[model samples]
Target: MPQGTLPTSLPADNTPKTYSGTKLVTYILAVGATGIVPPTTLTNVAAVAAAANTLTLRAAADTFIPSGSTLTFGTAQVITTADVTATAAGAAVAIQPAATPIAANATATYTNLLEVPVAEESNPTLTDQEETINVHGRITPIRVVNGKDMTATIRTLGGIDDPVVKRLITRGMSISPNNRERIIWLYPDGFALLATVNIGAPTRQAAAGNSQRVQVSANLSGGLFWANLNDPTPIWEAVNGN
Candidate 1:
């Protein structure tokens, strides 16, 4: 009776909206990398020096490897180098690899293939664990691949029959476990991440109280692939990452 109009609450610019004190998850399709398959391995004829990053082949490889192309040499040596020059067989040219060089024998090979980014989520846990030894109290050289998994809870205040909630309900029931899709987690602050995901069936629950409440839960897991040798960071701007 005292006020003629009510004040409207507006969210701050570049701020994320909170629901029930929890942030919502954003999911999307991931764009595929240009190369469908990994690059063919380039053969190495000689043993590369421990301090050297370049590779010497048995023949002129100027036509085989182009300039500004990213290639992987031996095992775990992914490098992006400048234009390669065609030189006499056994001539030493700069490899200019972006990452640490892997010690290679005569059988070492260089490849141009790359892994794709497979998944991203709102509350993601990425783990890259390594084994350590107690005898020397030192970290073991053995490494584990990075893995990610997260479960998201979705709630609807507009009753369980809400159109949007209904869509999710159908998706949870129909989506396949083998279907691999690209997912992107977007933030109001313009931060984003992209990854591949394998979705699981969703479960729904109902609460009994004065107000009608419904909740849906889903779990997903997958790995991420990277091709950028210059900067290998996963976090990126929303526009660029998307």
Candidate 2:
């Protein structure tokens, strides 16, 4: 090495030095290992209906993928809400033991042993006051719009009578919509929480072994990358197509 022999230039000091912005960039990390998005709700359904597929559901239902497992799928599409009754082997989901069955993805795997019913275009509709409990827990897709700790957008329209599964978005987690309901993951987050995080009223269930065993991560207002599920720091991911 020589002295001031003309340095090989330099990168911007203000810009992130990483190759991609979609990595582990977080607005805030959860404490003690759980990715918890403190309960927030979307009281304005009219505000959400502004989009074509306001509730975009992923092809598969997975919160996190265990290490050593594989995520597999066929094609790729922007998932909104998938047809549960039309998925691969997920069409037989039952709701007795609190089993949160998961749908397949481009490369995601199932650690929990619940039979996930294929999410179909037609979900069971219930009347108000009628209990909409999931006979079997499902790994459905929930979303964090504008960083509402309590409320998220699902691929399908959450029925007024159906109990939905709510959790923080897995940081850096993604789903590849191979087709209508078959999907998998590319990478997997090590640890996660599989509890029933209630946002609104319907009593969304995700008990220990019920039908739902899902994972959730947090993002600020809307970066879509790293989010603070339980952090009340007023973060906001940019709302596009609004």
Candidate 3:
């Protein structure tokens, strides 16, 4: 919650918890029934099928939408629609708004959309290192692509035997080398990091009333350190059987 850099005080309990931020925003209306190609500047969305009534987004069911919710798109265009209920991934639903000719680069807004929260998170930090050299007794800066590292100590609030923690541990074991998820910091500007955890382990520590607590420190790496917090789209495309 510290703004404008320069660490005013120690990082307190204002940290985030473990969760997923995969959701859709708007998609490119392909040229099928409606021949409108949306602009590329849209966020949290992908190009849908040719059908204008149906919208397509990229995400898993539990990570994108765990419950039924309504989504609306665009104010005026070729096919202006409102309150379209999005229940399933890639499933089309009907809507009614106006038959005004939709144009290219048009976007829709969904106010009630929500992101899955991280169960328990703390000790969030962002570290960056720049490689510079001095030539002719003067500093000559050279740009390097070594991105920053984002790490944190995560704790499962449900104690040592939490189901979610066990599930995450199993998932980490299965997808160790190649897996990526977004870590979004819920700030006013919506900061985020696209990262993957190659190592995952849990430990039991003594707690109040002689109980045990489950926790682990996670190291997350990305192609780049920072990202648009609002968008949870994958940074790389995965090809099957390649």
Candidate 4:
């Protein structure tokens, strides 16, 4: 028997017509019967124009936007060529998002207060008091320890005219205990130690043609506790869901 073959060409349609009403809906619904149709990315979009707070897109670019749909820029987006395609001659300038509010942490306000311009060194010392109890019949002695006393010495290039340095000098000159302020020692590993401190008089060393060196000392009043560098709220407060 001979093998059968299929036709290579088919008959052409002489009449063409557009589908409308229920036929158009039926065709669309049939195409999307399996699942929702996925959206496609629009390419070669022109820059957006803004006039009096109204944004307009060119006619060619309008193909990507639906007639009655609303467009929203998200928090992660910035209105600029770097973020979006708006680099045309009169394109809208970049508008950055609003700054986020700082966390209400214990040491938030004091974070930048002690930012010395040319700080050289910071030395912190913590000392504990010990009492020895000697029993007459015992060969060994028992030691009882008290709380720690914390102190710090900060060294920086002396600039008497600098506002921060001047403030430190003025605070050190006060003899009243009520002048104590909260001081935070932030570590590179995201840990911080916060303490109520009374600043002592600063000592200055001067030499010919050399910048003066200033050493400021601080005596921690209520001791210190370690916490997160940015948000140092106490563990108990966090546990209570504050």
- Model 3 alpha-carbon drift over 4 Å, by segment: 1-121, 133-145, 160-162, 172-175, 178-182, 187-190, 224-242
Highest TM-score scorer: 4
For candidate 4, the per-residue lDDT at 63 reads 28
Expressed as tens digits, the lDDT of each residue in 29-147 for candidate 2 is 22122333222211111111222332212323323211211111112112212222213222322112211222232232222221112221211111122223444595433443332
Query: Per-residue lDDT for 1-242 in model 1, tens only?
Result: 58666668755332211122233234433123322322233445565555566666443343344443444443334333544433445444456642544443333333332211111113544443444455577656454433334444444443333333344455556656444445444444444555555544544444577644344444444545323323556433221111
lDDT tens digits by residue: candidate 3, 32-59: 1112121222222444333455343222
Q: Clashes in each model (backbone N, CA, C under 3 Å)?
A: 10, 76, 11, 0
Indicate the TM-score of model 1.
0.34
Off by over 4 Å in 1: 1-25, 28-122, 129-132, 135-141, 146-160, 175-182, 208-242
Sort the predicted structures by TM-score, highest score first: 4, 3, 1, 2
Local error of candidate 3 at 40, Å?
26
Query: What does the lDDT come to for candidate 4?
Result: 0.43
Runs in model 4 lying further than 4 Å from the true structure: 1-114, 133-146, 228-242
In model 2, state the lDDT of residue 212. Answer: 39
Model 4, span 1-242: residue lDDT tens: 99889888856332211111121010111111222222322221232323222232222121222221212222111121222222222222233231221111101000112345455666566775545455786544245355567888866664775444565677677885744655555556655555667878888887788878777787877546665635655331111101
The candidate 4 region of ten consecutive residues with least summed lDDT is: 23-32
At residue 98, what lDDT does model 2 achieve? 16
Q: Return the lDDT, model 4, position 4.
A: 81
Q: Could you tell me every candidate's TM-score relative to the true structure?
A: 0.34, 0.15, 0.38, 0.43
